[model samples]
Target: MDVPHPFDEAVATVKALAPAVRSESVPVDDCLGRILATEAVARIDVPPFDRAMMDGFALRVDGELEEGITFSVTGTLAAGDAPTGSPPAGSAVRIMTGAPMPADTNAVARFEWCEESTSSQHGTTAASASVRLLRSVRAGESVQPRGQDGGAGTVVLGHGVRLAGAHLSLLRTYGIAHLSVAKRPTCSIIVTGSELCRDTEALLAPGQIYGANDAYLSGALTTDGIAVTECSYVEDSRDAIRTALVKAVASSDFVILTGGVSAGDYDYVPRVIADLGGQIAVRRVLMRPGSPLVAATVEGAVVFALSGNPAAGFVQFETLVRPVLRQAMGWHDEPFPASGRLLHTVKQKPVRHTRILRGAARIEGGVVVVDTEMAQAAGQISSFASANCLVRLDEPHVEAGTVLPLRFLDGALSSR
Candidate 1:
């Protein structure tokens, strides 16, 4: 059967994979990097009331230009302390930073601009009662007014927002001990091939290769916060593949199988998954390198069978599986391959979608230029290892200035 275009199949499968689980309440401390399920409304105004922004005296400011203007020091106000009535007219309060502004006080003057004296020093024996303003104070200067940051009932964080470190801090400031966030998805990876073995020390025969897909796949999934609960390498046998699939589906929300989905006679992933009552979503795509990609649902768990070649498997995972996994983890933005102009000529046939090799890139004169590291091939893992971005070459080989979509291995992409 002719395969569908890579972009078409990938987009279709992602849209079909519905979210299996949903949001849960987690402590604010653990909510960082998770998606918020509901808007977090501020229960109380930030600062709660008008408070001082500096260690100064709270006084009613009027036109005062004299070098030394004496005022009676009525009482002291510290942060969290109750006001001792509004500073009586013509009298100022000794207020510390963060202290609530007295009922009638309108401004604060820094200590450097103020001088103090005691009546006792002048006439002998009485409480200190004098303060002088060496500089005038302005209304609302150095004061954080009530609800300045956020008023009560204001939405500090909107629904569908991804929580970051700053969001956690904000939650703490708002006294939110717990918040609703989406649950993370769990995955299981199965690596199969009779020639593939996990033991690196074991000497490979003429047709054998050490298993690298399992390690790479597990690492990629874990980096995105998806837990890989089961990882196993099995010989290329129908029974072995079926057993592994059943086990993986039972234990994980998603199963990612690397190898054994191609058209070769020995490829057993597709047949075994179907025999075990799994529904094949798509068997192949019309893209180079990763054309044999397959996705299915075995006993309700999604299974992604990728190419045996490292490069092909990685591309398939990024294009097909990454989106579903990220969505399950509450990520709003689906991963899309970035677009950039090729720095050099990349030759490819116009018959199929092409994924070319590329290294790091930089913006020069407002254009993203990708440096081609090596030729494009499905089995060339070396180029993929050294590549930071996949310079996409669509059908019809174009010149150096042609804009093509680029996929960054690190999940970042150039703007198209």
Candidate 2:
């Protein structure tokens, strides 16, 4: 029997399955790509006080002066050290970069612009400094005022923000050592087929072929950060399928099974899941090659049964499973296919959703061009190896200028 489209059912299932994972506090060093659970507020104002931007003398500028005027140097200040009290009127304080400007000192004159000399002032030994009236130093010139970058009680980062390298640096600037982040979800894969053999050298008999679904499923899941801890191969027997399902459901948050989902008598996945009190949410999809896709929840654990064919299983995972995984991991956006124009004409079934074969994407004449390859058979695995995207075919046939939805094989195009 024909089944509802898996894409439609996948959206409903994800909405129904509320986020079950909790949040945890982790060190900022390990929070890259993790979702923030709370807003990060600045504990103190950035550059808490007025400070000098360069090595100069802190003095109150009266009027433009010639070489005759002189001022006594009170004391010296360096970065990270306190200034020797405010400089008295008619005198200057020697200060370095990052040193706090003394109170009542309105401006700073760079060392290169002033001339140094020695003279006795008020019967005390002191060095006289004067500067030719090259330019006037205005108040607060070249000084970073207090709270210029950030102020206390200000929200620096908001909740649900994905931490990047720059965000981490800001967190360090605020002295944030630990941050609250959402926990990541876990997933498992199960491969089933009697004709499937691990070692290719172990020649297959008349009705046998090497299993490629396990490798494809495992690699895809791993790239998404989903842990595939359980990988088992079961024959077409009912008892073996039941055992694999029970074990996988117990240990994994989500169970992915390859093969044994079709309607044939030997296809035991549906029966085993039903016998274990699992409800089949979706039994089939409208898409070609992946028409036998199945989704069920076995004892509260999500289970996805895909076709034995590698291409079919891979496409099913990218379209239906990846988005659910991302949601379970607390990602805010739904992972969907990118939209691009077709480079060549392609045909499809009128009533069913089709995925046309495509190679890689290139930019030609400042436009994206998706190259099409030969028609790939449903069961062919080699065609998907180098394939990057599945040009969605909503209608039976499409022309070269058609604007179609393109789902990337990997998560690469989801960003576009």
Candidate 3:
């Protein structure tokens, strides 16, 4: 019997076989959640020019401004108004937030910090207005310098960066109307089991259960922005699995099959892949709950055969499948594993295989604490409801207070 591939070796194989990065031009409005294929260079400076940072009076101060210094109001500047003329010395311009700073003016005093006064002739307003300084002002105060956000020709966003809402807004600030992003990958999912039923609304026959693999796999891929081209629930027949594989490989960049990879009487996925001229890259992995994982390449499309058990499939998908898909889409910066100390001792039958179990991780008193008290069964999915991470236990007998590696799930990395 051949030895099962080590977990790390299997993951490395999958990554090495990932498809090369491909790029496509997309509008900036549609770039959210897309990975950048190339570095985003700024064509123009953000903010473009120096402007007022708040609603204030733009001042031309020759030296330190002291309280009670008066100045004549020359003009009013609102946002989008160009500076047509400079305010002479000892003069000020009433400026609104985001308005271009007038020529020769180096500082702005907020309206609340200045006292406006105008002379009245026979109860009528005078043509000239003046303001009294309530506080001191200096150069660069309340002034937003040009290119403060980003300078022209600067690489604002690096390659392989995943665009978020804030990233899109920043690109818009630099007048970036279009973006070069990695081409989105397509996926096809096949769930094989003669006893699997699709509809929960209808009464199930004997020895049949409603299928959750399809829903979980499809939803997970969709949530990550991968397009699921096909989803099939086939019975445990060799012909049915073969037919599904042929169609899936034809249309998708990758194919995912849950069930029929283990040494069962009805396990036909691995054989079917071989029959279709596909080469198996990884026959199995040395990991608990998902040791029967298999990776194959067929007709330029990679296939991942996983165990049908909900928790097992979920672990394999998160640990191996997701990372490869990310690489194919040009995301190179894999998240570093989070480190935390185990809160209690955990003992299991001595085995060399790695045990990946659902766990909850939290920071208490400036220290990371990991708790793996939930049910760690291959078939169970209930424990995932409260699990925030997956704890990797390499040894069967683990001592308490030992630091363990954790991988965040459900976007926990964002918060961490």
Candidate 4:
């Protein structure tokens, strides 16, 4: 077996091998959660015309606001109605929210502050009524000026932003019907183990365990907006593994294989990858739970072989595979670790390798506190029940109240 590379060096190698980002034009309706490949600049000013911000009366104000000022209501305007000739002096237009303001209107008085009079005896009918302002008004009140939200040529959303629901609304307001976004990476999963069963409904035979890594990895990648092309289950036989690898590499940009990377009689993943013309860049890493990780490139597809251990595979995917995938999608920023104080002492024999422990993190008095009481075995997945973070430790044992580096599992801070 070859000497394992340092954890940081191994991660760097895998990330550096990521495929280049590609872009495609997609309708804005389907762009949620996709990274923008180009800046979304407004083609036209939002609120193309001066608009009403509330249900009110549009009036032409020349000077100081006067109390009890009466104006003849010339016409009623609703949203989407084209502006007619501006009302004569001392006349106003009844407008609804979102209606375009008349060219001559300078101010709006909300209905709450104005009283309407339709007395025919005063030479005024309902069609042409009088409105009296009960309170003083200010110029531009209840009006949305043209380009108030955004002006033409303004960069509403910069490149590399992950589109969300709110972003879609903003884009539509600027008449952006489509957007250039990073293409989602295609991936495949190859699970190899003779003792693994893929069916969840069938009863497990003696000495056989249900395969879980496949479902976990597939769901995680899908949630991250990746296209999982295929998921294959193969035995430890070299022939089966090779055939699966060939198909996966041919069809997907990324292939993730669980099990069969370590030095064992049944471990044929690395050997088969090499036989299939793969250039191995990373053989192993100096990290606990996921030290036997391997990265290679075969026919332009990056392959990752992670430990079969459930906990180990989960840790490797979150720490290593996820970053490379994000980079391939044009997201260059990394998730920064948060400083967390240990709430309980963690007792474990120290090894030369860096240990990553499952933890439950919470905010206490504005400080991040983590609990590492869950099972930390490589094969056990019970830790996932409450573990939201992975605590990084260099020392053998840590005492309570010691501050350590913690990485949130979802890449965002969601403390209990």
Off by over 4 Å in 2: 51-79, 90-133, 199-208, 335-337, 354-359, 383-385, 408-416
lDDT of 3 by residue, 271-324 (tens): 999999998888889989899988989999989999999899999998888889
| Ranking according to lDDT, highest score first | 4, 3, 1, 2
| C-alpha local distance difference test of each model | 0.77, 0.74, 0.88, 0.89
Give the TM-score (vs. native) of candidate 3.
0.94
> Whose TM-score is higher: candidate 2's or candidate 3's?
3
lDDT of each residue in 1-416, candidate 1, tens digit only: 64565665565775477465478888889876787877887778898889998887788866443557778888778899988688778887888899999998877777778887765543564444877888766777678889899888888898778788998889777767888877877888889898986899999888988889988888887777678898999888999998888888898889989889988888999899879888777887766668887777888788889998888888777766787777776675444556777777666666766454555665777877777757466767777655677665656666777777776786543443
- In the range 237-330, model 4's lDDT, one tens digit per residue, is 9999999999999999999999998999999999999999899999988888899988999999999999999899898888888889989998
**Window of ten residues with lowest summed lDDT in model 3:** 119-128
TM-score of each: 0.88, 0.82, 0.94, 0.94
Model 4 segments more than 4 A misplaced: 120-128, 333-336, 410-416
The positional error of residue 95 in candidate 4, measured at the CA in angstroms, is 1.4
**Each candidate's root-mean-square deviation in Å?**
3.9, 4.9, 2.6, 2.5
Error (Å) of candidate 3 at residue 172 is 0.9
lDDT of 2 by residue, 1-416 (tens): 64575556555764455346458899999988887888888877888878888787777655443444566777777888876577787787777888888887756777776666654565664544543324456667657888899988788898878788999999888777888887766677888999888788897888988887777777866765567868988888999999988988888888989998998979999889989999777887767668787788888788889888877787777767777776676665443457667778876656645454555555566665676665477767676656777766667777887776766665453222
Model 3, residue 200: distance off in Å is 0.9
